[model samples]
Target: MSLIRHAETSAPNIFHGAESDVGLSEWGHKQAGLLADHLASRGAEAVYCSALRRAVASATPIAHALGQSPVVIPELHERKIGPLSGRTRDEGWGVYEESKRRWIAGEVEFSHPGGESFADIDRRVRPILDDLSKRHKGGRFLVVVHGIVIRVALTSLLADRTPADFDAIAIDFASINDLVHDGSRWRAEALNLVVAPSPARPVA
Candidate 1:
């Protein structure tokens, strides 16, 4: 059997918490439960999460459903946003237009004020991917991590896209992306997918 790689964006996090232990917000809790149900339905054998609370909480319900405790990997943690970690989108440099342009241009070399560049994130996540391949061959795994990390991983694996193309891969909170690892290569199976929202409102 081929290895199924399910990667998820962690729940929405509050911009609070000290440098070491930021956690999920109230909305994140709700998102985590929904994501749990989503991942549970896929029936992964091993549930893995980043060291952050948001990722851990996001993976918890699914882990329970599978009767396994989540395996936490610090390497899976979100890319460090540096001093911008708790700042609002506008408060950060390259907030709106320029950032998007840079991203689409495949430039991962530029750094944020106190944070890292896309290349930095790629470096951190690459080793993790290698480890997963070696340790979990022919198995299904769910990785609960962050948006930037997803982008970096995709940038590394995609056949026709540069890091800049990652700008268009919008991974919402708790959204899931799918991939597969054959013996030697990794392939993306799908991009961001949201669970269909219940139809209780707007109709055509």
Candidate 2:
């Protein structure tokens, strides 16, 4: 299965958490189109996305390219940022970073004020991914989600890896990461694969 991060938003630097419903920016739409073109021939049998607008929009083009409708799963939404929802990095990053630090240091119970903890994300996300993997056991599918969701899910899916191990791995917008299920386990195939579009062409 291919796990994809949603394309950029209008305010790319802002913390648009699970409660925020922002859609794609102009460049984000172009990126989404490019992603669609890149995956059109990959023979994906289904497409899934978080219930958030950005994720839904990102999945639309790919789903169209594959001739399948996207299935929106609310449980796949990004970690709830709570009070940090619309704050820019400069305004609220400290609290967010500290929470992540605590999570990586084995403090899974720590959360930003009103936000979800690492354990909260793991509890809700893993079962859904497991079920989806089972449903598409012998086939490929697409799942459009957020960067943090991808990171948290990876930590849980891979036994050897931990949240700290993936701290340096950047999950860019519209990037594709592949996961393979071998009947009993899931493993990462490729990660952070990006498809850049031509600079001269304008997206209409």
lDDT of 1 at 86: 64
Number of the top TM-score candidate: 2
lDDT of 1 by residue, 19-115 (tens): 4355555555565666566666677768888777767776777688778898888777676656656655455535434544675676776665655
For candidate 1, the per-residue lDDT at 196 reads 29
What does candidate 2 score on TM?
0.94
Misplaced by over 4 Å in model 1 are: 1-20, 93-100, 196-204
In terms of lDDT, the poorest run of 10 residues in model 2 is 195-204
Best of the candidates, lDDT: 2
TM-score of each: 0.79, 0.94
Q: Tell me the lDDT of model 1 at 154.
A: 78
Q: Per-residue lDDT for 124-170 in model 2, tens only?
A: 98889888888987999889999888988887787567877647667
